[model samples]
Structures are given as structure tokens and as C-alpha cells.
Target: MAMTAGVLALVLCVLCFAGFWLGRQEAVRIRSGGVQPHSLPSYYGSYVALVCGIPASLALLIWISAADSLVRQFVIAGLPDHLSALPEGDLALLLTDVRNMAYGRVPLNTARPEIVGAVEHYLRLGEISRWLMWLVVLALAIGGLLLGRRMVSAEFRARNAVEQILNILLIASSTVAVLTTIAIVLSLIFEALRFFAKVPVTEFLFGLTWSPQTALRAEQVGASGAFGAVPLITGTMLISVIAMLVAVPTGLMAAVYMSEFMPGRLRAVVKPVLEILAGIPTVVYGFFAALTVAPLVRDAGMAIGLNVASQSALAAGVVMGIMIIPFVSSLSDDVLNAVPNSLREGSYGLGATQAETIKLVLLPAALPGIVASVILAFSRALGETMIVVMAAGLAANITINPLDAVTTVTVHIAALLVGDQEFDSAKTLSAFALGLLLFVVTLTLNVIAQRVVKKYREQYE
Candidate 1:
């Protein structure tokens, strides 16, 4: 049925194009006879094409979406009264399986006559829907062509109409992207709400313990899986701090060097090398953190007589910080470079040393962009999963010491969903709640970054 509907829709579209060509030919003939229209022949063609295509295409889409459900309803009504007694949800599932079986994709396990009858009805209804859809599309296309042909005349302003339609279509296309973002956020919000209902928001927010594993069977014994998210939050914070410690100075210095100090020939060589850091996959970074960096950190800590887990927050955080350095340096470098050369020249004319000019003038002027870069880096650090999962231990220690093992929220979420988990369990729902919290925190940071950028622009302008 879907294939039939698609083919019919394609036929209508081709016919619309033919109508457009015919309209253009007629318009050219009129112009040759010295009764030129207000718009060019091609504009008339587009206008006719739009008229024939848009309405028919819309009708085909609506029919395709509605046809299956409508057919299923009729089929269900024809089913035996005993079959109708089943709950609507179960009935829908059974019908779906039966239809799948009828299509030869799968077979129903049950041998009930009602099920067999329903499948047969479903197939017949599908055939009817296909035929009806083709007829509707043909009618819409023909009507649109006839109407468009009547409007083609010397006084017609086809170009203006076509442009107006295009403008509306462009806005509609852009709106779909914005609406999709909104829909995704709303879905996250609702799922998170369901999670929060199972666990107290305060406990999820501020509890110190971080264990999320719960007993699978009634016979199992342990602390009813600690949902205290504090450890995860602390781990995230600690890793972010470590990342910033590594990234900020290195990234800022690199930006400063690139913008104010490096000669062009050297800059060309160095900039691409630095940007190559940004292209490295996070999974590759994870392996480096897990295999190379974590062991090294463990050995270094042992040498210093400090207790460090093999997978420690410090190792992951440091690697993550290294991963994000390019993000900070590149954005900061561009913003710094955007500052006018006049500012540097004036500072130099005033006898300020190059270092002094960069430190006092350019740095302060580019502060907002620099701060935005830091916030963006921070968000990335907080949201990082692979490095932390590979290098940081799963144990959720509430302590802030970087040498100790810790679990982050992202790692916890990943662990919870990695296996088949019952949907209603606190362990599973906690992932959604954590995701919501993550989203909120990142969104807040982004909003603040935008505001800071705006303030900076206002100050400079």
C-alpha cells in the first residue's frame, strides 16, 4: 500500500511538471504574438508547477498517513465480537502482528480463526486504500492544472505570486528545524518528570551516595541501590575543574600566541596542527585515557605515596581537558584576531610593550569571547562520557580528591542503560532524571554565555 501511494504521488508530480511546461509554451506563444504577460514565461511555468504540485502532494501525504489507521478501524469492526472484547492496546498489538504475518514478513504464533480473518480483512482494506489514494491524487492534480491554466493571461503577475509562495515555503522549512528542537526538549522534560516522580528531586539533587544498582530479585540483599547523585555530580565537577585547569591556560596562551606573537609562516604551520586535536575521536581519547594515562597517573600517585585508583578522576579529567583545548584555543583565537589592528597600533604608539598591549588591551577587550569559550569548554567537560567511563572508576565516592575513584552522571546513565533494564525501576528512571539535569545545566551555561557575549558587544560597540 505504501509503495502504491508513493508511485501515485510520483505520477502526480510528473504530471504537474508537464502542466508547467505546457503553460510556459503557451506563454511563449502569447509573447511571440505581441501579447506579452507581465511576468516572464519561466515564472508562469513555476506558478503553474506550484499550483499543480503543492495541493496534490499535500493530499497524498495526508492520505498515506491516515489510510492505514482508517483501514485498521474498518477491519477491527468486522472482527468477531469476542475478539473485540480484548483491551484496545492488546488488540492493536495483535492486529499489528497479524498484519505483519499477512505481509509474509512474520507469522503469528496463535492459530485463532479471528486473527486469521482479521489479517485477511486488513489486506483487502489496504488494497482499497491504495486505489482510493491514486484516484484522489489524480483528481487534485487535474483540478489544479485546470485552475492554473485559466489564470495564465497577459495581465497575470505570475512572478510576484511565485516569489510570495517561495518566501512562505522558506519560512516553513526553517520553522520545522526550530520546532523539532522544541519537541525533543519537551520529550526529555516529560520523561524526566516521570523519573522524578519515582525519586525525590532533593535526594537526586543533593544526596551524597551515588550507587544506582538495585536488587533484581526479591532474594537479593544489599543497600537498596543508593540513588544519591552527589558523587556523580562531584565527579563531574572535579573532572571539569581538572579539564579547565589544563585547558584554560594552554588554550588561552595558544590563542594569545597565535593572535599576537606568531609570524605568518609559523602560524600557518602551527594552527592546523592545533586544530587537528579537535578532529580526534572521543573514543580514541577514551582508550588513551584508559590504557595509557590512567596507569601513568596510578604509578605517579604511588611514587608520591598517595592512594590513586587505576581509574582515577584525575587521569580522565586531564585527558578530557587536553581534548577540549582546541575548542577553546580556536574560538578564542578567532575572536582575538577579529579585534581591529588599530587597537594594537595605538597601544604600540603609546610606547606600551607588545606583552603589555596584549595583556592590558586585547585581553580585556576579548574577555567576553574568552569567557564564552571557557563556559563552552566547561559544558563539554560536564557532558563528557567516554573518557570518564574508561578512566574513572564506577565507584561513586562523594569525596572531592582527584586521586580517588569517582563516577560521573554521564557514566552512571550509560551504565544503567547498557543492559536490558525494566522501565519502571528506579535505576532506569534515574538515567532520565540525570539526563534532564544535564540538559538544564548545559542550557543554563549556554544562556549565560550568550548574555555575556551580548554585553561584550554592547560595551565594544
Candidate 2:
């Protein structure tokens, strides 16, 4: 795949350069004759480049999509009768092993005589297919370049042609986004429906326990699949609340201090250092939460005569909050700065103190954006997985106590889909249902944020 892509890119670049030079030469000669072309020479050149690049790109995309499957089918058809007579699943695995051997993923020489011969055949077919793809794509690019070069004339509307192609590219980009969103929603809904077929919706929504372990075999022990999700929902909300509790006050205060009181030199240095927290990986936070914070919390609880779980949600939530502090602080600071200096000056002109001016004028003006930052931080809290996994153990207890170990929806989804399993099984399908729920929750938060922004934002002239 990588080799084919590089070759196709080189071909497209060469053809684009050829078409650009040809059209530019034609435009220059006409301009030298004291006749203005319909558009700039550069626009004509761009038009030619687009003509050469677009068709070749589309052909290359089509070839890459189809060639692998076509090659696989051909190889499968020519397999030995005994291998082909294997069950469908086994046969599929056999073919994959043969291909792996051909690609050096497996030892090539240890295979049976039949498998050895088949590996050679698969390699030969792959080589032929790649060569064929390169030929067809390059031919299309050269053909487009020649056609575009012949069509460039003094009266040609190169600008209009370029604009039309630009519009097409924009429409294609928009269509891909729309189609991708629709596909994801449809896929989730489809799998959730499959899950609902085996497990009652009421059970999943209202049941207190969430045990999604179904035995693949009837003879297996301890396979009672309880698909309750309320505990997971409760844990998610608890963690989010803890995170927001920690982030909102501290982040907003930091933003207020930076915007209203701190010196410019100190603010500049502190701001980036604070934002460095956001760039650190969640896995790193997970480690800090588990190795450092969890122990601290446990020790603190013991010192204060309180019981704390080994893996407490408080530890996860606090670290997660610290991780998302920049999200709130940075946005709130920008919004605070966005409040017109005129408002502050007017307040000061009325003999108000600086603190009063901030409290009375700036805070209200920046409230909408501050609210958005908090909501965003909450959403980030709810979506966190690694921190929860490492610090808040996967014990789905429906409790609001921060010191208790609890698991969130994302952790459960990851657990359900960690290893190979049948997609049609209710246990696996539950992940899609959990995903749909998470999507709705995030969507609701965004909608509420938008409504608040629209209604309450302070408009400035």
C-alpha cells in the first residue's frame, strides 16, 4: 500500500508540473501579443494542474480500494481442494496465514508443499496487480495533462474553470463529512438494535448491576449476563461532578487573576507552563493517578480516620480535573480579555475599585464563555478512559462517594471490546449501545452550550 501510494503521488506531481508549464507558456505568448487572457497565467496554470491531478487521484483511489479484495479472491479460488474444503472460518484463516507467509509475517520455509506453492502464487499476483494499478493511474494522469494543455487558449475562462473545480472539491469534502457522520450513527443504531433483541431495553437502562459476561457455550459456568448500565451511568456522573468541582473554581480563579491582577511578564510565563499540562498524554496522567495520587488519597484518608478504597474515583477525578484545567483557564482568560477595556475604564471612572469593576462588569460580560469552558471541561471529564481505568478500578458500584472505587461508561466499553468476540453476541453489542448513550450525552452538552452562547453572550459593537 505504501509503495503504490508513493509511486502514484510522484506521477501526479510530474503530470501537474507538465500541465502547469504548458498552460503558462500558452498564456505568456498571448499576453506578449498585447492581448489579455481571460484570467491570470497562474490561474490558467492552476486549472491545468487540477485537471491532471484530480482524475489520476480518483483512479488511484479506486484501484487501491478494489485491488486487495480482487487479489484475495483470485488467490482463494486457486487454493488446493483440501484447503478449500475446510470450513469457511478455517479456510479464511488459512488464506490469511498463506498471505502472512508471503509478506514475511510468518516463516516461509516451514509451510507444506501446497502452501509453499500458494504463497509464491499470491506474491506473483500481488506484484502484477500493483504494476497494473500504476500503469492505469499514470496513463490517466498523462492523458489529462495532454487534453488540458491542448485546450488552453487566450479566450479560455481559466478562472471560471478553476472556481468550478474548487466548488467540486468543497462539495466532495462536505459530502464525505456528512456521509461519515451518518454512517457512524447508523452503525451504532444497528448494533444497539441487535443488542436490544437479546436484552431488554428496560433492563439495560434501569437495572442496578452491570455484568455483561455471557458464556459462549451452554455448559460453561458463571455466565449469567446481566446487562444493567445504571451503575456505570452513576459512576460517570460522579466522576464528572468531582472533576468539575475541582476544575471550575480553581481554573476560573486562575483566569481571573491572570486577566485582572497579574503582571504581564508573569502571566505570559505562567500561562504556557499551565497549558503544558494539557499536552501531556492521558496515559501519563493515568500513571500519576495510580502510582502517586491514589496512594496519597488513601494515606490522607487513613490519617484523617476515614476509609478510602485502594482505587478511588476521587483520585481519578482530581487528576483528570488537573489535566483539563487549561481547557477552562485558557478559554476563560480569552473571554475575559475579550470584554472591552472601555467597560473596565468606565467602571473605574465611576470611582469603583479594580476588584469591583471586574466583579460588576467583566465577570458578567465573560459569563457566557466561562460557562462554555466549564461545560467543555465536564465533557472532557466524562469522556476520560485511561485515568478511570488506572485510578478508579473497574468495579461498577453505584455510589456517589468519591472515595469509593467506581467505573465509568467508557471503561466498560473498552472492557467489553478488549478481545476477540462475536459481534452478534449481546455482550459485544453492548459497547455500541454504550457508545450511543455517550454520543447523546455529549450532544446534549453541546446543544446546551450553544443555547447559552446564543442567548447570553455579551454583544460588542
Candidate 3:
């Protein structure tokens, strides 16, 4: 079946390529006759290729989804009535075992006659389906090419037709991504609903305690599980707040220095180094937070006559902030740079000092982008896992102090599913609940950032 699918894909690819070549040749032939049209020759080629490829690709996708079920039904129909009466899922599993046996991997119960017959039928149906698909695809491609060729006349508006088709194609491509996002959100929602069924939704949302271990057996003593998410949420918010405190001022200042103040040579040398901060792995940042930053923060706090845990929220948040500085600075710098030089010149022309001009004019003009960058950085900080895990303790404490150790949603989720837990257990289900929360938070931040950036663009343009 894999071989047949591969061959069909390869044949379709060749036909599409041929259609592109033919379309281009026809466009060039018409152009050589001094009859220029709306679009370039490549657009015509793309249009032909798209027409020849899209329908066949869609058909192949549908066939791949349904072919196994169709084959299994046919094979099952020929089996004994008793065997056919099994549950759908059970019958499907049995058919899967038969296919495995046919491929000589393993025998399903020593290869009974029924299984052997089903396997034989499966292979026969697969071969027939492949042939039929190939014929249909070839005919479609040939028909599309012939139609395109007939349409390529002296007065034909191939360019407009091609562009309109391309517009639809682009929209279709974008819709796939949008739909995939919707599907992911829906899946998370259902999993979270399952978790809320086991644990009360209000408790998950508002309760302060977060121990997820429940009694395994009915007779277990003193094993009531707490599902309060307040601690995890508190830790997440605290860490993100500390990270933003460190990142926002530093990043904005850096962007200001680079975009408005720095000389060209220094800017050239510094921008790449700043960007290199972004390329460093988060796991490496985890190690840096654990081994270097946490100890330093503890020592510094002790020197200042304050009590601090060895693994503190301050250390993790600060390090994560450093990791995200590049994201904020680089994006802010680009947006600042994009602010028209004429605006700056106009400000300078009014005898405004560079400092005053930047503070009153440039910063206000670039405010939306800077806000977007900060929101983006906040989202990154919230989603960070490794740094917090390595540098902060797993204790879910409802504290506001950065010097105290705390657990975060991501760390809790990681701890829950690190090795293996039963899928139906509350512990495992809690991970999905946390994942749903994380997804929603990040998605909300992204939506707001996009809106801000769009408004900024509109304001300036």
C-alpha cells in the first residue's frame, strides 16, 4: 500500500510539472507574437499546475483516510457471521493483526484461515484502488492541461484568471493553519472538560492547594487529593512579573540605544551579539539558572540581610528574562527603525534635542509595537519550563515573595507526566488541564499583540 501511494504521488508530481512547462511554453509563444497580456508567464504556469494538482491531491487525501475502512468492510463481509458480529473496534483490531501477519511480521493467533483470506483480500483491494486512483488522476491532469491550452488564445486574460485562482489558493492555504489551530484548541477543551469532570472546575480554578495524588485503592487512608490551581498560577504570575520587570526596561533601553543613539559601527557589532542571546538553548539557560544564577542570587540576598532560598523564583525569573531580552529588543528595534526618518527629522527641525524628540515623539509613535513586544516577552516567560524547573523548587506555595521557592503550572505538568501515569488517572488528566490553560493564556496574548501591532501600523501609515 505504501509503494502504491508513493507511485501515485510521484506520477501526479510529474504530471503537474509537465503542465507547468506546457503552460509556460504556451505563454511565451503568445508573447513572442507581440501580444502582451495581464500577467507574467510564470503565473500562467502556476495556474495550470494548481488546476492539475489540487483536485487529485484532495482525492488522494480522502482515499488515504477511508481506504482502510472500505477494505476492512469488504474482507469482514466474507467472514463467518459469528466473527462478523464482533464489535467494530474489535474487528478493526483483528483486521490490523491480519495485515501484520500478511506482511510476515507476526501471526495473529497462528494465522487462521479467516485471517489469511482477509489478508489476501486486503492486498487485492489495495492494488485495485491504486490503479483506479492513478487512472483518475492522469485523466484529470490531461483534461486540465487540454482545457488550459484551448484557453490560451490571443485575447485570453490568463493573468487575471491565474491571479484570482492564486488568491483563492493562498486563502485556502491560510485556512488550513487556522483550522488546525481551532482543532488543537477544541482538543484541549475536551481534555480539560474530562479533567474537570474528575475534579471540580471551580476547585481547579480557585482553590489554593494543588496536590494531585489521590488514593489508588478504595481502602487507602488519608489520601484525599487537592486540585487547587492557585499556587501554580501564583508562581507562574510571580515569575512572569519578575521576568517582565527585568526584561522590559532593559530591552526597551537597548532598543532605544541601538535605534536612536548608537553609532553605525557599534550598532553593527552589538546587534548580532544581542541576537545571539536568542539562539542559546533554553536548557542551557536552565543550567545557567540552576548552577550560576541561583547561588549568586541567594548569596546576594543574604549579603543584603534578607532570607532567600537556594533555588528562588528571583533567580529563575531573572535568567528567563535575560533569555527573552533579545526577543523584546530586536522586535522593538525593527519597529523603531521602521518609524519614518522624516518624522525624526521633522522633530529635529523644530530645534528639539534628540532626547526630547525621542521621548515625546518616537517613543509615543512606536508605543504600540513596544507594547506588543512586551506582551510577546510576557507570553514567552509564562511558557518557559526548564529554567523554572531547575532553579525553583516544586513546592506549591501561595506566596508573593520572589525569595521564596514556588511551583509553576508547567513544572507541575512536567512532574505529573515525567515517567508514566495512567491516562485515566487524575494526575495525568491534570497535565491536560494545565496545558489547556497555558494554551489559552498564550493565545490571548498573541491575539492582543496582533491587535496592538495592527493599530500601530494604521496609526503611522
The lDDT for every candidate, in the order shown, is 0.86, 0.90, 0.85
Question: Model 1 over residues 1-461: C-alpha lDDT tens digits?
Answer: 76787688678878888889978987998899989689999988888888888888888989988988898889878988888778876797778787787898786556577787888888888887887888888888988888888788889999999999999889988998999989978877887788788678898888877767662433344444667788888888999999999999999999999988899999999999999988998999999999999999999989999988888889998999999999899999998998888889999999999999999999988999999999999999999998888899688887788888887889888888876456666777788888888988999999999999888762432
- In TM-score terms, candidate 2 sits at 0.91
Model 2: weakest 10-residue lDDT segment is: 215-224
lDDT value for candidate 3? 0.85
Candidate 1 vs candidate 2: the TM-score winner is 2
Clashing pairs in 1: none
| Candidate 3 C-alpha lDDT tens digits along 15-63 | 8898888888888888898988566777677778877887788787777
Write model 2 residue lDDT over 1-461, tens digit each, in one string.
76867867896898899889888888898899999999999888888888888999998888888888888788878888887788877788888898899889999878899998889888999899888888888888888888888778888999999999999999999999999999999999999998899898999999998888752533344444888999999999998898888888889999999999999999999999999999999999999999999999999999999999999989999999899899999999999999999999999999999989888889999999999999998889989999999999899999989999999999989988877566767788899999998988998999999899989987887
**True lDDT of residue 408, candidate 2:** 98
State residue 23's C-alpha deviation in candidate 2, in Å: 4.2
Question: How close is every model to the real structure, measured as TM-score?
Answer: 0.73, 0.91, 0.77
The candidate maximizing lDDT is 2
lDDT of model 1 at position 240: 91
**What's model 1's TM-score?**
0.73
